[model samples]
Target chain A: MIIVKIGGNILDNPERLQAFLLDFAQMPGPKVLVHGGGKIASALGQKLGITPKMVEGRRITDAETLDLVTMVYGGLVNKNVVAKLQALGCNAIGLTGADANIIPAQKRPVREIDYGFAGDVAGPESINADALEFMLEAGLTPVFAPLTHDTKGSMLNTNADTIASVLATALAHKYKVQLVYSFEKKGVLQDAADDASVIPYITAGKYKLLKETGVVNAGMVPKLDNAFAALQQGVAQVLICEGEALPSINTRQYSGTTLSLN
Target chain B: MIIVKIGGNILDNPERLQAFLLDFAQMPGPKVLVHGGGKIASALGQKLGITPKMVEGRRITDAETLDLVTMVYGGLVNKNVVAKLQALGCNAIGLTGADANIIPAQKRPVREIDYGFAGDVAGPESINADALEFMLEAGLTPVFAPLTHDTKGSMLNTNADTIASVLATALAHKYKVQLVYSFEKKGVLQDAADDASVIPYITAGKYKLLKETGVVNAGMVPKLDNAFAALQQGVAQVLICEGEALPSINTRQYSGTTLSLN
Candidate 1:
């Protein structure tokens, strides 16, 4: 099974999204797609005169921002992806954590910075892996939004990368899962400005050296952490690639970075 | 099985919706809830500077209106309802027609006025009864949004009443189905101005007389049409009642107008 997480860069670009989804629809075997919110929500929030609160490049989801993200991520982007996949002959279903109690989480506790309405996955046990396996076995491809519910009455903004990693790890026992993170870039780059500087493969040692040298910085840290976590938690392989290169990954023809524990 | 359709008036009122949902939550049996879009979509559309086009009190959905409704109805309202149901201990899943390809529809053809993104149900065949039955058997209550999708990648604005009716009729083969339409009114009233004028029972003949006497006026015509159609299509019973009286209907203790072919 393949679990693909598409970032906002691809989602915000229509041509890129269309090309990527077309590839995704044509891919064989059971698969799931997790997507993040694009600029649409923040733009809409601005229109509503809601200023977003950010701490250390992470969004602090207030009540109003939660509603906005739910509307845009769960509603607009998720449905559109499902509809397009359906048109391309993929039987797709859109889901949030609350749906069918698929991935229930607890609201984040107030720490140094209170991230209001944000959620943290309790663990792999928090996921309804059996339900997901049922859907997959039944030939249903799930497209997930970056939202989860507390099993109480609240929807929370969650990180899509975290969702993908957790789902991959949870489902690994049942299927040989390949977790892929697809974005605009070809792969992790040694030089940010050079598209051809894509590092083809990285082991734990290489990753550490790259991080120490500051070649891998900022947003890439948490993403790589999630990838490595999935690998350690029984996921077969993890790939970081451009959205268009996703279908080629399984065939060993993709130009992307592959991560391994050793 | 009981299939309840909640109208916009009750949904727009949080206190009323909570009361109705509480009763619905406590009800016994396998059930489904279908909800219509409230004023939220229209209000949001206005905020986005998109004017709605309505002909003869029916929304004429264009592309922009379709997006707005999809976000508000399929996203915000559906998730909120599912989250609340989860809190109340009812395992609920939210769905659009595109989800799991559960309800596939065709775009409404252009007639006198083009209903751009509006959809018409082809019939019971458009419903995936087996999927619904599977979910219900698995102890999941489905909450449907007022949207359906063309298998060819377009989400259409569908009527919630029609969705409920079609679902009840399709699932009738597997379960003893009761279809309930819950709105602001206690029941179908003989006098529109009098809250106490709810007609207790209406056979086909009584409905005709009510219609001829102008007691049943414009907005209700389609609702009753759907209810009667459900009965004709093998649904066991149909009721029109206040949203709060939903739980009492199955116990033969409700104060709603019951419809029969007699």
Candidate 2:
């Protein structure tokens, strides 16, 4: 089974999302949805006078910002996605971290550096894999909003990437399924400027060297880290590439960046 | 055991972080860390003429912003925290999501609404909790940056709060620990205008009520969300209170907001 996660951007693009989801539902083992709605949330936040702050690409949620996120990520975005899936003839369940206890988080210690009302993953322990599997078995896709719970019954923010990696690894561990990291890019470029020159594969030793030499820069740094990490552990294989280009990842096939322990 | 996550603002006030780490190291529990550094990241981004885009509180990391985050969250901030921990009588290791396979993630799909270069939690796989537990066993504290991994060998932006929640839950599940959501004010204010009105306990039903009719307001939304998530699953209890109080989450003491399942 290949576990597929569509980004919030994809979800935002109705045409693309509908097309992608339609294709995804037709030929899939278990498809779990992880998404973003930063645009919607931030737009609303700014309109509401909450100064939006961010580090890198992740938003720094303050108390006000967090409220905007819930309305968008949990309320607007989550329900709309579920509705779309239902319209597509797919049985989709909309989940906020609160439902069935999916994502549990910890409150970050306060500091002069206020990230506003943001939170982190204390544990994705609440991910009901059994429920997810059941959805898949029953031909239903679970469209998950990045809303998780903490022990105290509060919902928290989550990174779609972290959740996807967790589910992919967890599901892979549970069943030897392949984890696919789909995006708009072709794959990890040998040279970022040259997207066509994909770095088909890299060994752990080389990965370290690449970092040491500084060829690995910016966001690419962490992506490679997780890719290598998955290989070190046991996750069958991980494929990173543009979603529009292919249906599935097979080492033999001509497509995205593939990472494997082999 | 309790996992104390110092915020990036603590970095702004080195002396404060140093002081907190001194006590945190001495406090009891199997601990892991998750932190943020938006204040520093944004300052540099502005100097570089990058008008850091935020969707909600999250940043949309493009190539340039990513570099800035690496420097702030991964380099200076991470190192500074480590240095402080060392001085505070704690054996602390500084890490980004790239190291030790902690927090693997993936790029969000390109939403029609651009969160700039921002990312959200997709999956939270591959945290080396064994190493964390090993550190806790040896009384070593792990100082973490909020950076996470994409399926590629790239670094994706992750919110600190999300990071803390994930780490708290992960460590708690593995080693059995308590979590504290300390801030600068009274914990979980029943009324935002009145910080002293801390709610010692909350439930799912109560949380919904809080969200309605304006009690849950803005910032506390995600904070409360993540807190509830952790409590629902593995965390023994989650306390939301003032960070300056330090090492004490007692609800009766008016230290911070203490959340319970009851």
DockQ of predictions, in order shown: 0.84, 0.02
Write candidate 1's Cα lDDT for A54-164 as tens digits. Answer: 997767999989988989998988998999899999999999998988989999998888899998999787799988998898899999999999888999999999999
lDDT of 2 at A39: 66
Candidate 2 per-residue lDDT over residues B1-262, each given as its tens digit? 7766656556567667666666676765556556677476676556557786666665567776765675456644554455445444454555545443445555677766554334455433345455456545655466667766553435567777777777777776665656766576666777777876877777768888889978777877988888788777677777666566665554355566566667
Compared with the true structure, what per-residue lDDT tens digits does model 2 show for residues A165-198? 6666656657776666666668877777887888
**Root-mean-square deviation (CA) per prediction:** 1.4, 16.2
| Chain A TM-score for each of the predictions | 0.96, 0.85
TM-score of candidate 2 relative to the true fold = 0.49
DockQ of 1: 0.84
RMSD of 1: 1.4
Candidate 2 stretches greater than 4 Å from native = A1-262, B55-58, B116-119, B122-128, B250-254
Worst 10 residues of 2 chain B by lDDT: B116-125
